[model samples]
Target: MKSSFVFLCISATLAVLTITSAAPGRGNANATIPANRTQNGTVTCAGLNDQKKALEGFIAAFVAILFFGSNFVPVKKIDTGDGVFFQWIMCMGIWLCALVTQLVLSFHPNNNNNLNQTVPVPFEPEALLGGFLWATGNMFCVPVIKCLGLGLGMLIWGTVNCLGGWASGRFGLFGVEASLPGNEAENFSGVALCLLGVIMFVFVKSEGKKTKSNETDDERAHLLFSKKIQAETESTTLKDMSKASDDLDDSWVDRLNPKVKKIVGTVMAIAAGLLFGVSFDPVTHLEQSNCHNPQNGLDYAFSHFCGILLTSTSYLIIYCFIKKNKPQVIGEAILPGLLVGVMWAIAYGAWFIANANLTQTISYPIVATAPGLVSALWGIFIFAEIRGVKNLVFFSFACALIIGGSVLTALSKS
Candidate 1:
């Protein structure tokens, strides 16, 4: 019963993303789809929706927010490798879904019978590069999780991701043009609220490193040993402990300095978010770039996922040699990785649809806020990574900020 409801919810969420943004071309972030404009400023597609469509779109947005927010839940249960091997599995699932989508789209004709092509055809180079950019950011995920935990890590990066994706479209960063359908103040104010939320989240300590503090403590093992065993094991454990400390001291990334680890994780998280934000730059280029060869949606999806496959494979191969040809492989972790891959593939697939249907200015902020909500819930209830009355209060405040920002952003479209 529970599983069925979850599946139903997922379907409904995908429906919202597909229905709300599916018509694309032009849209306000409110519960409605606006008419799409052509390059020459003429209304090319009407995109007017009945109440039924509007309602469905609203419901689907609700579902999408939850699903996108919680899609990474599976990864929390299992132990993954240094991220390369696990990332490969996730990318494989993304590609699998994209391949299926492409095959399905091949049956449909995007152009008239004369052109004989699907929608968004021509397979632009920039579109493929966009996927690679996203994959590069994803490569740092595991290390960030290990150090920062999901709640804090996702919050920090999610903010940056939202800002980057939204800003590029809002202000036309990187030569991509803005396609916002509403007043500028409405959109920018929403962005400000979102930024305020991110700032609030940053001050909330995650109690993350404490989880590892005991594991690294030399006397932890001594406490587990019996009285007589403690006496004998003390010498052995102390020696082993010294060796363990030495081992930690050897690696630059995994060094014994907590401050350094925190800094590395934070930097990686920032980079990951920035990369993810730019992942859709090619799609924007297709719409706005002068040299762009607009391809069909199917080809775009295929090329994007292909980038994920190609880039992830290269990263995994590089990591294999770095690990001295003995890469860590956990058979048990594969299932979890696959699960996240499938879920993320679906969510991301919807993302493309949403992007096509609505500009990044309207969609990215709402989509980005979800994972933090879901992950923070997991962190608090499932993992106990977040604790203390003070932090909980901050968590509540953060949630309010996110909700307020999202609502204002949506209203900006109206």
Candidate 2:
């Protein structure tokens, strides 16, 4: 089933790519040029460029949403341990994708000057700040998941992420220029609906089995007993030692008081959402500010990814030091981590394109909230994590709001 799904995804992606490549006005430099201005001071692109840009932006956003929603599926069943090691491995994959992107941009015909020689894209150090912000937020995932569970944690962070990202672009926060959509009322309403939908997701309980950390003491003990009986031929002392080691490896979040854990998880979720919201600020700043020549969003991808890799490595080193050089590392998680990273990189790259073609105000809410719908679908159909009539009803309602919100947001830009 997984193989079939993978094949379907690949085929769909290829089909989209073929269609996009053949689309009218794509890659036409003149398409984006301001050909005229109306009496109201609104700028308009030439001919079909405006329509084409909108199409491209929506397509890129769809791809981003799909990839972001499914990126973690590979590692869903794998033991990621503390996640720091897994994140570092994933960063490696992200960096590899960035390297490939850099190479492609270098060899692209557009990079050639009047002399017909390729001009290498300059690395923008400012973009590295975005990477640092993203990696720092990612460091909180395991704790948040342990403390709040995946559903609630995602609900809080995803809502904040949608609102924060939309507001940043809409209000010009953190030195980015404000990007107002053509239809202010529609845009604001869309964002509000999207946030509402995301908030509603918290009420949809998933029936997936609890993790070891969430399991009751009796349940854990019974599981341990079963394991002991299965390995009865082995030494009892060794088994006791192994269990002790496992207990020692447990997350500190698991040991926290319930009330304290809730507070910490909520705080972490908010912080992560804030960080994720502003993670693209540096790139936006570079494009808007005169401090540096304006560049395409893709040009900054390598620098941003490099920052992620560097920050993740630094965090991993600190984590190892804190764990006395015995940080939790699951060997089985390495490949899945890399795969997740690669998928994230591709999704983020598409996000960059979407942002460039359709202002962040128009794209942020859709990208941030639509993924929840996709993920919920995955849970309902593939994972069977979400079940029961009540959950399904809530999921359907949330999907309606999100899809409606996205349409309105897109139309606002148009």
Number of the top candidate by lDDT? 2
Instruction: Put down candidate 2 lDDT per residue, 332-368, tens digits, no spaces.
Output: 8887787788778878988887887788999999999
lDDT of each: 0.67, 0.81
Residue 351 lDDT in candidate 1 = 63
Worst 10 residues of 1 by lDDT: 23-32
Relative to the unseen true structure, what is the C-alpha lDDT of residue 260 in candidate 1, on a scale of 0 to 100?
Answer: 76
Number of clashing residue pairs, candidate 1: 11
How close is each model in CA RMSD to the real structure?
A: 7.0, 4.5
Candidate 1 per-residue lDDT over residues 120-237, each given as its tens digit = 3344566788889999999877778766776578766777898899988787888778676466787777777777776777666665424355552235544554454555555677
Quality of model 1 by C-alpha lDDT? 0.67
Q: Which stretches of candidate 1 lie over 4 Å from their true place?
A: 1-64, 109-122, 145-152, 203-252, 256-263, 290-299, 379-391
Q: What is the lDDT of candidate 2?
A: 0.81
Model 2 residue 14 lDDT score? 67
Candidate 1: residue 404 lDDT (0-100): 83
